[model samples]
Target: MVQRLLLAGMLSGLIVALFAFSYARVYAEPNIERAIALEEGGDHHHEEAEQGTVSRDTQRNAGLLTGLVAYCAALGGLLAIGLAFLHGRLSVRPRSAVWTLTVAGYVSLVLVPQLKYPANPPGVGSAETIGTRTEMYFIMLLASAISMAVSLWISHRMARRAGAAPSIAAGLAVFTALASLLMTMMPAISETPYDFPRALLFEFRFHAALLQLVVWGGLGVLFGQAAEYMEQSGLRVEGTARRGIPNA
Candidate 1:
């Protein structure tokens, strides 16, 4: 069970971490494209366009990356708390605190914005566009700072059990994100021009699907935890449990 605790804690934290990184790519790609279309110095690759200049894309993507990373970090803390419960390793107060911050952070970043503006993009230019964009940046920075601290605590808690590298988890996450992006592309469906290489057939549905479902989602604790728990229980009954188990 101790080992399980360590493994679960690490896996959960990683799931959240990957989600955070995936959010960045999601925000960057389309947001950058929109910037290229809308703003003066949006496309850096274009020589006529100024490079390294901050445009709406930078603001939007920056805040988005910040906000999502923060949320995921907090979620990692929350997952750590859940791991603690499973392991009998954390106190109620500390666990509750971590869980609270996780939910609070997520709502503040992902949900609260909905109160002022809807979560999904609403075709950019409305009266709300300027102010909404401004508000998004403010929230992103605030959330990112708070979440980073919480994530650090989570990482410290899971240092031993989270044996896998963060980079590995990130790979799974980004893979899923790429799948999601392909599945949702509008340009391909509409015969509109998209510089990105994508299609409606086998490429995404099979190749991308495999990585997303097998690699990324497969590594998540939430999905695998219950099954693993049952398996461990069965093993303990069979006298195959870890050395800590008392002989029955």
Candidate 2:
């Protein structure tokens, strides 16, 4: 089980890393160049001077690829642990677990706080306020995660009495109301320049959300398949042992 999980995690990480590298190269890198141009007062010489010894190729390829792969690998390992723990606890089969984990990943990690505090491109925000903004974002993230967990618990408890459909509706209502209220209550951070292109900003955010979806969705599918295979293999070995079969 452990070996299967680790292998799945590595493969998922590799896939996510490749996807991110491509997306960053095409979508993110151009915005970064534009931001640097803006920061350099649109002076080509100044932009060239400000760039340190680190080559653009190295930054785009080696740095980005290494960091992304490492980060995704860590995320995959954590996800594997989560899937293992959730096994049998959620009364879900391997396939259903994939759906559950994918939804939870998007809701808890991306959707909730993203609506409240969307991702920004380079040179969009105040450096002085970065600490405060980060703190606020994390607080909102924790709140969102807790709200989802509590809502699910409430739904499970209510299911015993009110039944599954009613309980799900009630839980979803609670989640929606609470999440909306929290979003309203949370402090807003608006740092985009007044003249910044709205279309570009929209594109950046769209790609960012898509990136999260790819990683989480990929992890769920690959990990679930590997786990199911492991389970099936274990059952086969157990059955063979029960039949007093000799090794081939």
Candidate 3:
């Protein structure tokens, strides 16, 4: 289990970085990088960079990269390792933890700033100008939503079958999906009274991303417990089925 978890973590990391590299190459780069002065260069000018849809191939590959590397690292290190200390099982919660980190982490970095406080030059309409670039955003948009939905849904089902406390799992899933959508709406949320968590742990938009990865440390524990239960059930089911089979 230790070794498998380790392998999973490494593979997941490799994939995630590669995905980010590709994403940086495709999505994260061109749109925002164009107007560096307005964005990274510390000018709050809003420029609307135009974009289009992200094909399924790009989306799927990104998803796989995200799901595997980014996820396993946090989950394996935090959840899995922690579980061995407490209740040991390869539950699905760690999967959720991973989903949250990778998804939230990247969005906080890429989408949040651009969407809410994008740097726009005078000509927001210009292709390179800063405005609402629906085309590019949606590429990650469609892929992440679908990825979260499928993984969360599968976890929900597994949680139910395992008779585990799935409310947290279910809530996590729904919250995750909503958060993803909300992610694209960070600017709007930032404006509203609801605001956001103010504590450095949850607040401070600049470090919003750092906070995401950091908290996964605790989220890892929860995931580990869930993972333990999942492993138990899978083993149990396998044992029962084996016993039920006739002798060869």
Candidate 4:
């Protein structure tokens, strides 16, 4: 099971990497170039200039590919581990597992934190505050993960006491209340200049969200298929071996 899941994860990661590389190369790279141009010397000028250690070519080509693959591979491995733990809890069938995991992935990883901290293009934020911003984003992510886990536990307990429908409703209500409170309490960071192109910002965020959907959705579907195949094949082998044994 572990070996099969590991292979599935690698394959799923490759799929995500390919999709990411293509989407980023097409939609994201141009916006990034434009941002670089603005930073270098454009109308949207700021007092602080962003430093660049690497050339745009490397960033667009090798750097982007490397980062995407590494991130997706690691994410896929973690997801495989999650699926392993969730085995038999969600369902024995791969299709059911896929459906459940896809929703979980989107809600826990993408939807929650994005509501608090939306994605921005290059020119939107200040270089000096990058460290602080990164720290805050990770903190938000961690909080969101904890909130999701707690909500799931609550739902499971409630389901046993009440029923599926009521449990779902109560879980959603509690999660929403908690998430809203967190969002309200968390410090907001808005560094985008008023003059910045709203359309570009929207487009960047849209593409970013789409990228997450593609990667995670692909992982769920592909990994589920792989796991199902392995399970079925193993069962078939076992059946064949049993049939070959002499009747004693």
| Model 4 pairs in collision | none
Model 1 regions more than 4 Å off: 1-7, 16-28, 41-73, 82-109, 119-248
Candidate 2: tens digits of C-alpha lDDT, residues 1-248: 66666677677777877877788778777766666666566757544855777765677689888988887787777777777777667765765776676687679768999999999877688999999999999999999888888888898899889998999898899888889989999999998999887887887788778877777777777767777777777789989989999756
Model 2 vs. true fold: TM: 0.88
Assess candidate 1 and give its TM-score to the true structure: 0.34
RMSD of each: 15.2, 2.3, 14.9, 3.7
Q: Report, for every candidate in turn, its global Cα lDDT versus the true structure.
A: 0.43, 0.79, 0.45, 0.78
Residue 22 lDDT, candidate 2, scale 0-100: 86
Model 2 scores worst on lDDT over the 10 consecutive residues at: 38-47
Sorting all predicted structures by lDDT, with the top scorer first, yields: 2, 4, 3, 1
Q: Model 2 clash tally?
A: 0
Candidate 3 positional error at 216, Å: 11
Against the hidden reference, what TM-scores do the models get? 0.34, 0.88, 0.31, 0.87
lDDT of 1 by residue, 1-248 (tens): 44554455455545654554564455334544543444333345443553566655555566655654454444444445454554434333433434443444444443333333332222223454566566554654354445444554554455456743663354334433433443343122122224323332223223323322322232343524543564467667767446657667
Off by over 4 Å in 4: 42-52, 244-248
lDDT per residue for candidate 4 within 81-154, as digits (tens), equals 77777777763486566556667667867888898889888778889999988888888888877787788789
CA displacement after TM-score superposition, residue 163 of candidate 2 (Å)? 4.1
After superposition, candidate 2 runs with Cα above 4 Å error: 43-46, 53-55, 160-163
C-alpha root-mean-square deviation, candidate 1: 15.2
Whose TM-score is higher: candidate 2's or candidate 3's?
Answer: 2
